[model samples]
Target: MATTNTTTPRPGGRSARVQAAVHQAASDLMALRGRAALTVPLIAARAGVTPSTIYRRWGELSDLLADVAVERMRPDSEPADTGSVAGDLIAWAEQYRDEMSSEVGVGMMLDVLSSRNGVSVEGRLPVPCQCAAFTASQIRTIVERGVERGEPVPVIDTVMDTVVSPIIFRSLFGSAPITSAHTQTLVAACMKTARLLAPVEL
Candidate 1:
């Protein structure tokens, strides 16, 4: 008789169950002990998977964190077209600021930024910044709408800077998070600089 080749199944098989358990455990640990206390051994023990599983899948602490953190963070969803560029822009901006200032949103921001901001491991950059990218798409959509109307829209980069930079600065540095009023004011101010930015009720 030939001997059978039987290998014990890897813990959780890299399926959704394993990933969910690992992700949940990682977050719970982060909340309890802070990022400084994170480690493969610690996470493995917490996640109930072997150290090899995490190492093979995630490679290192930063990579594991970036993976988990990105999974949890969500950017504001794109708003439906309101048939006016300024109106659309103001609506999206309000949603964006609200998302960023919410308790859940603030925690997500803290989780990602606190995890070394993509410092590399084995020369590999940490998790990609997909969290705030959806908001940028809204900006593009608004700018292109103005362009289509034959309005002299500012360049996309300029429009983004004019609209987003100050809001982020205030969110990160100011005593209070930005409000819908704040975003509306910025949107109105940016509109003042271009024909594409024609005044509209925000």
Candidate 2:
């Protein structure tokens, strides 16, 4: 007996084209006119799609903005290689703090949080979120590098919980300034955890 194939075909043709065009248009407009000036009609006009097209796909402006924010936050390159795990963590943490604490970063963070962000056509949530996934990928790189050099390193979740989460929480709530010193403090705590968790040789 022959089995039936149940795979969903990848999104393409007109749907893919429209999505690409709209994403590009939204990004360009956000850069040129800022987020406050954006509207579904303006983006549709720029993308050569009807406002209904966007509404049909994304449901609302906040969801559209969240999708765009996820795209914009995708990492273009690997985290900086600063030799030791501690150095790498320090560098990555400081950079992450600076970016996420900026006016634009804060806005993007809010956009991602304000909606479902990127839900697949199958209705699945992005789980860890695309932005958080990107951050985790960077941390994985740092951890792998440390392991390669025989240095003890905390797991990815340790870094995320210790360093990334605090920065995000503080940035979003404005509980404290995300200064370099604050980032360093977080990194130091992460490294301390790693040291304590390291296995003792027989």
Candidate 3:
């Protein structure tokens, strides 16, 4: 078990530092070694804390991994409002592409979803379905904003199915690289398809 010797306190206290350390360890491990190798004991060892500390804080490895997955997927900055649905969608797709390409992001997502039905190291669902739901919500926001601006209402699911799903699918399957051009094309096509699919009011 590779372990780090440095320890620093967060503003809160020992508990905060412990939690931070645990997450840091998880991220580092997942990035260095693919998801299958990430374990609670390994994370604890990396953090220079006892395995009991991780268990006490997160209860299981899965739970910790899930939280780590969510944290990794979270956008570094708010979604860009580019004043055009096409531009906005392209920006969103690019962000997703960036995350999917990173070692931490891609590895954690694959591991978490693989254990979706099983207990994580924390003894819970590896990935929370809410993360997907939240992503859908962001799509909805983009659609609603477009409608308000007099752009056609967008088909939320179609966009998600076409653009977002493929990236994850390809990453997990070890298929061809999902390049920037692929993301741009998907966004453009989805935006057009969404307009056609949106319900038209009388």
lDDT of 2 by residue, 1-202 (tens): 0001122243599998998899999989999999999999999999999999999999889999987776667666677888999999998788788788888788888888777546556676567766777788788778878877888788789888989888888889976657898789889888886742323320
lDDT of 1 by residue, 1-202 (tens): 0001122233455576777888889889988987678888898898899989988877777767876766664332445578776787787777667766666556555655656545456553343345445445556667667777766555555556777777666777778987778789888877776654543411
What overall lDDT, based on C-alpha atoms, would model 1 receive against the true structure? 0.65
**TM-score of the candidate numbered 3?**
0.70
**Top-scoring candidate (TM-score):** 2
Which of the two, 1 or 2, has more TM-score?
2
Order of candidates by lDDT, top first? 2, 3, 1
Give one digit per residue, the lDDT tens place, for model 3 in 84-154.
88888888778777777666566667555644434557866535354565566667667767877778655
**What lDDT does the true structure give each of the candidates?**
0.65, 0.79, 0.69
Q: Model 2: how far is 87 from its true place, Å?
A: 0.9
Can you list the residue pairs that collide in candidate 3? 60-121, 60-122, 61-121, 61-122, 62-120, 62-121, 62-122
Off by over 4 Å in 1: 1-21, 24-49, 59-62, 74-77, 120-129, 195-202
- The C-alpha local distance difference test score for the whole of candidate 2 amounts to 0.79
Best by lDDT: 2
